[model samples]
Every structure is written in C-alpha cells, then in structure tokens.
Target: MNVTEVISPTVKCRVHLHVHLDGAVRPSTVWELSRQKKLLLPGNGSLKDLEEALQIRSPRDLAHYLQKFRWITPAIAGDLAAIERIAYEFVEDEARRAVLYTEVRFSPHLLVGPGGQVTARQVTEAVMRGMARGERQFGVTARLLLCCIRGMTENYDDTLDMCTEFRGQVVGIDISGDEASALDVDGSVNAGLLRAEVRTFQEAARRGIHRTVHSGEAGPASMVKLAIDEMKAERIGHGYHVLEDEELYRRCVSTGVHFECCPSSSFLTGAVPLTETRHPMQRFCQDGASFSANVDDPAITRTGLEDEYALLRRMGFNEANIATMNFNAAKACFLPEEEKQDLLQKLRQAYGVPGCD
Candidate 1:
C-alpha cells in the first residue's frame, strides 16, 4: 500500500525511537559501498534496482530476517568511513520525512575489520562523529544505542564498555537475536550467554545507563517480564505478545514500559506470523500498553516510518492516535532534557491543533 494514500507524509508529524544503523542505509549508499569494496551484489542497473535486489523480500523468522545483513555487513560493517557515512545518512533520510527525534542503534563488534585492523572503539567513535554531523545538519536530534548479540554476555560487556567510553554519545544497550534463543523454559538464562547478559545488565544499571531489550516479538510474554523485572529495561522492543498475559500486561501498563512497535518488521520477523487485517499493535493499543511506531530496520524492510504510520492508519488509527504514539516516542527518547523539551514543544504545536485530532 502506498504511504501517501494512508496519510500525507508531510502532514503526519513523526518521531522515531527505534531504528538500527545495521539496517537504515540507503540502497544507493550500499551500492556505492559495494563498488568501493569490489563486491558483486545481486542486482542490475541503477541504485533503485539494487534496492529491490538487496531487500530481504520475505524473511519468516528472526534468523531468516538476520541473514539479510550478510549483504550489508561485508561492504560497510568493517569500514570506518562507511560506518560514519551510514550514520550521517540515516538521520538525514529521516529528517526529510519529518522525523524530529530518532535513536539509531548498531553493534560495534560487528564492525571488526579483517586482519584485526579496526577496533570497536575506533568504529564507535567514527559513528559518533557521523551522527553528530547528521544531527547538526538536519535538525533531527539522535542518540546511539549499542546492541550486542543475544546470549553473548561478553559481547554485552564489550558494548557496555563502549557505552562507558563514549559516555553521553551513547544512550543505551540492547541485545539482538530472538529473546527465546537465550532463555530456558523456566525463564533463566543459559549458562555462558546468560551470565554475560545478566552481568552486563547489572553493570549498566550501576552506571545508570538506560536499557531496552528485544523481547516478546518472537519469544513468549514471559521474556518481556524478564527484560523488565530482571534486566530492568525501560523499554521493550516489539513486546507485542505481552497482551496474552494479563498480569504481565497489567504490570507493563501500570509501569508505563514503552514498546517500540515496528509494523513492517513485525511481519518480516514472524512476530505477528499472520495475514490478518489487524496489526499486532492494535491489541497493545487496546490494552493501553504504551508504544512508539518505528521502522525497525528501514533498509532491510525497504520501508520508513512513513510506511509504519501508514499501516497504523490502515488498521484504524486516526491522526490523534498516531500523534499519541509520537508523543510516547518523544517522551521515551534518550535525548537531553533541554532538547527533549524543545521536541515536546514542537509536538504540542503539531499534534494539539484541530485537524490533527
């Protein structure tokens, strides 16, 4: 469905708190990187054609969805210049589409160059440089969230250390991979990976760092509970399944734990795993679990926040409901108080007006 048919892209005031650098690059950028790196990607003709070719098409599960990164990682993952450019470009892309605030995430470990040439610290610093430039240029304020592979606690420690090293440049931590993959049926973490995730969570808490875990998207509702109660996350990425568990639902609503709901990514990851007209988020909306509409991996899904908001509108959300989601995103974003207040004021002007309601 065309996004403009659902809502005028220019009219819909927007905010994005969940986006990934690993998946936000423009196809034109990827094609350029591939050419520079001497890699032959699966496409012909112009950058537009390459975009069609590079997309994941239809991934059925989290593992399947992750494989699409293979096309992205080799070209830019290890290159410092590519990392910086991608960061800068992501914010610029969203800024054109009216995103006032965004949170872009990536795994520094994934950028390890061949032959031990590049360090995660170097890569992360380069990313910060690029993002700062993007923010300055576009007026789209952004923060970085470092993600680690799930069940890889040492990876988490490395991520945490990067977060500490970067200080204010980094906003939070997240663990990717399916939440169920790292947990036992009893809700305990597996031996090695479990220990590391727990330790990293503790250290992040001690440091007063923010956290938002990928949970309940594909895992059981209990995974969301574990993320909040055990890991002390302030936000839950794709915690759509929480609606099935009443106690968990009550706790999430009462605690006001924000859910970063990405409509397109939900279908791609098999989180919703259905073809119904209703999106998974409708239930979350009905239950009053706070959420923000996101474009989880914009490039991989070949979509932007406009597409997500379009889907929400098709599924029966009015402009006011979508603005509510934007408000949730702006409030939960890891921005400085002064900057956040500025955004909140902008949102008030954009959303509080007559036609928006």
Candidate 2:
C-alpha cells in the first residue's frame, strides 16, 4: 500500500499522551473572555491585541517566551465558567485531532484572582470540574498532572496538599519551569531549591504518586541524568539533551522512561532543530527510545495534536512507526492496567491488526 493509504488506515488508532491544558486555551476564546470581563488590553483593544501578546518569534529564549502568558491570564482568570469552557474546548480539539488519551499538566498554584484569595484547593477543584465536564462531552480520556513550578519550591507543601485534596482527579506531579533557570551547574540560587524539589518528588513517590520532571529541555545530559537518578522521574518531559549521553540513553531505553516530545514547542524554543528532517524525534524513535509527540502549547504554537502527527509523517515516519509511538504512550500512561490494555487493544483493532480482541 502507498504511504497515504497506510497513514489513513492507522490514524484512528493513534493517541497523543502529552498535552498542557493551560497552554492549550484558544487565543480567540481568551480574547472573548477578556472582553466579557472588561479586562484592559496593553495594546489596541482587539483580538489583534491578544494575538500580538501571544505571538512568539524566533530567537526568543524559553523564559521570555513564557512571559507572554501573563498577558493572556487576565482573559481566563477568576472565571470558573471560562475555565470549564476552555477545558471542554481543549478536549474537543484533541478528539478532533484523533487523540484517544491525554495526560494534561497545569500549575494550579498560579491560578488566582486579583486579590490572591483563591486557594490552591479551589484551583484544583475548578480544573477537575472542567476535566470531568470534558470527559462527559468528549470520548477522549484525560488525566491531570498537577505541576509545581521550579522556582516556587516554597509552595511545594501547599501544592502537594492541593493534590491530595483532588486525589482522584490528579494522576501525577510534575516539576516544570524554565529548565535553564532552574538547573544551573554552578551553585546558584536555585541549587538548594533543586535539592529540596528532589526530596518533594521522593515524598510523592513514597505516597504512590506518579512523578515526572521537565529536565534537559535547555540544559545538558547531566540534568537529564539528575532527573532520572535523583528525582526518580517516571518520565522525562522534553529530555532533548539525553541523546548526548550514550549510557543514559541506553538506561532510558532499557528502563522504559517515556519522553514526552513536544515538536512545535521544541522548534519554537530552539531546543530541537527546526527543520522537519533534523528533528531529534525521528532519531530518538529510531534508537528504540520510547516517546510520543504532543502539542505543548496549542494556542501559542498555533498547532494541535494533529499538526504534530502530520509533521512527523512529512518527516518520513511510516505508519508502523506511528503505531509504535502510540503504543508507547498507551503503555506509559498512568491509567490502570486493565484500562491501558483495553485502549491498546482498541488501537490495534483500529490498525486492522489480527488477534487484537
């Protein structure tokens, strides 16, 4: 069969595992929310203003690029209704992109009103309410990962307490932020914070909570090693530098540490080479390193789960490779073994594989 035929036949089976809910809010929706809330705009009071605020150009570092979210927050802040709507919309968009399952991460601590009155527990409840609504509306299954910002280690206790409050709703805890800012080799301000963060991760593991760390996104292989060895991360989010360490790469491959690869975000942030052919995702797959392509920020990157899959196809990934990638995601999911098996079987059946039932 031709490439087109193979891809078309297998598209239904593919699942995108990595997604960020807060980062996936539609820009137009944000603008509408801002207008409804009578929020002031820094620029001209129009959708163009919102777009300009979210627009990220090349050569801008990750920290600077992330700063754009401050402008968009006003659009979604203090509105549980808007949060529910955006959450539903995000899941709907994922379903449209043929995603069967997703694990979305968001920092609940950062979501607050102008008075800073909203507690972390309230934030978690609102997000869970949104996700519950989305699951009911869309067939796509989703689990939330409550993330703790790297620099905000002081809030670790509160974040963990919030996670416990929404225990059933949250599947994991992630330590995510500007990797370059957090993982300094020299004894910097965040060094002690990083050590404490590892202890928090260990505590989470002891409490039977899944843990993943955003490591090596902008740093070296040593950072990735630290996440695996010290933090005991079940998965490494955007470990782009892991390829530099041969031994570490082998350990990851043999130990089955999933790498949540966000192609558009990596390209935009200059972590991975921008060219489709030169993207490290292909090499990582070829080397038996398990990973799944994800839309890190649908709104900011102006791309979705389907766009990432399409990009991979254009980069010469075959249907079989794509199927394997989806399987890797399914296997690495935080869901129960029975649920994972059911999904894997469904995926195999969709691909017309014999004996799937």
Candidate 3:
C-alpha cells in the first residue's frame, strides 16, 4: 500500500472526478490559516493530530462525526485570499497525485462568517477565481459543484435561489451533510424523501445541469433508491449501503449510476466495517457496478487519491480495473464533452491503448 511504489512514472493514469475541494485541503494549509487567523487548533502541528481530531473512532451518532468539520471552518473564512490559496493548493496537490481533471464541491453558506459578513455571491466568485488560477497554473481542468448542506436553515427554496444566482459558474448542485440527519426528514420513515429536494434537482436537470446525491452513506439502501428514482441522481456519493437491496443493486448497475466510493472514510465511519477485505467496494465491483475511488476528505481521512488507489490495488485490484474505474468517473463527470474526451484520450494513452488517439 505504499504510495511511492504504485505511483511510479510508468503508471501515468489520471483521476478525473473528485468532488470535495475544501475537504481536500492540506493539513499544513489548515495550520497556516489557523495560525494567521489566531484560531486555536487541537493538534501537535502534524497531519496525524488533525486526523485524530476529525476521525471518529467510537461515535454515538453521525452528527458527532460530522461536527468535526466545524473545527476547520474558521480556517477557511476571512475573505477571498484565504479561500483562493487553499483552492490553488488543493489543485496543486491533486496534480502531484496525477489528477488531470477534477470537480470540487463546497457550500458557500458556511464560508460567510458572523453577522452575514461575506455575501454568498462573493463566496462563489472567490472560489471560481481560485479554480481559474489552478487551471492556469497546473494544467488541471477544474469545475465546481455548489452544494447545499442538509439540515441547514435554508430550505429548498433558498437553496434553489442560490443555485440559480451562481448557475453558470457552478456545474451542479448537491445535498451534503450528515446522512443520519438526512434520514430524519420524516419522523417515521427511515429514509428521507428527496422528492422535495428533487424539485431543484429536476429544475437543474432541465437546465442541463448534472445531478448527484450523497445517498446511502450511513442510511438505508432505500435512500440510495430515492436519490436515483426521485432525484434523478446521475451519481451517488458513498453508496456503500446500496448492496442491501438486490433490486436497487441491479438497477444501479443496469442504469450506470456511478458510485463515488471512498473506502477510508467509509471504514473509519463504520459504514463498511474496519477491515478493507470486507469493504463493499469489492462486492460492488464484482457485481459490475460502476464506481470510482476517492479520498472523500483527504485532510480528515489523512489520505490522498494515490493512497485510495494503492489500498484497492493491494486488495487485488489490477491496473486495468483501476483504469476502468477512472474511465467510469470521467464519463460521470459534469464537465463539457470536449474536456471529457480529452481526459479519455489521456486515459487511453496512459494505458497504451492504440485506438485511443
């Protein structure tokens, strides 16, 4: 599982679709921002310290696990410069891991500090500016997914308005937060009805905006089904629980619902159990379900894209399988066709396929 051994120069395959930008910031960047802002961090000036604080070993509920992100939110505040620096560094880090294209997502709601300081419009512009900088500096084609955190005060109407205002700059909209809280949308139902949220998703779809949902992470398999059936999610984030329903698994495979699988986070959160051997990723792959590996929260999970791939490789995933996963991800991305075609060409070249050119 050594990153160096798997990332040899000969292996030039690229990771094209990862969706969490702020979540992927380096610990050093977090520390630097914390220090500059005079914010207190509970670490010994190491990535391990950050990981220990963020990673929940024995959590009573999902909210306790998600509360960890609140600790890092302050570091990301204070205006465009800080946001831009972290965005640039995030792309640079991805480039080092051989990622040629990426789609990073975040909710601008929390970026604004106390007293409604930073406007939502400003937050969008700052992030897009940083994305442009990353593209120019690193040759990594980037896109943004403006997300709405579930359980936030803003209901569907407010979220729709935000998405409409930043429509062009944002490629899509996603609902992300604690899956456990999402399950609480209704008192008796175990799975939340995304039907209400589907109004925005459908509207985005009509406008040709790609849609994806953070479903089945810690909830029942029915939640994943609702995301696909109700929300028309082209992709599912952390869809580990989908295997619970045979019908849903069949539909997911048959219909090509790309699952953005993150093993490290799933393992740490007790979603797939601790051991990598018993992880649902293997089962999902075996069942012919399309999926891509991702470092859901590189900063918190203390991992990188390379580490995720290396772990899968050790667990008996071949290079070709990894390449297929990458191809699936590229196809599932919310980028322009020309950009996606370019990435497909790169993938073919990396794998030494003759007809790819």
Which prediction has the highest lDDT against the true structure? 1
For candidate 3, the 10 contiguous residues with the lowest summed lDDT are 3-12
lDDT of 3 by residue, 55-93 (tens): 666634455556777667888864678888778877767
Error of 1 at 139 (Å): 1.1
Instruction: Give the better candidate number (1 or 3) by TM-score.
Output: 1
lDDT of 1 by residue, 1-357 (tens): 754223234533688878889788877788888887788777564577677765667758888888777777888877889989998888778776788777888888888776647988888998999999998987777789999888555566678888877778898888778676776778664544466676777789889888988888888787787788888898998888887788988888888899999988898888887676567688778876689889988878878787788888888988768878888788887776787777788877776654332
Off by over 4 Å in 3: 1-12, 43-64, 153-169, 184-195, 275-277
Tens digit of per-residue lDDT, candidate 2, span 143-241? 788888977888887777666666666878888887766644672325564777888888888887778888877777777887889888988889988
lDDT of each: 0.80, 0.76, 0.74
How does each model score on TM-score? 0.90, 0.90, 0.88
Badly placed stretches (over 4 Å) of model 2 are 1-12, 185-191, 275-277, 354-357
Look at candidate 3 and give me any clashing residue pairs.
none
Q: Residue 25 deviation, candidate 2, in Å?
A: 0.4
Give model 3 RMSD, 1 decimal: 3.5
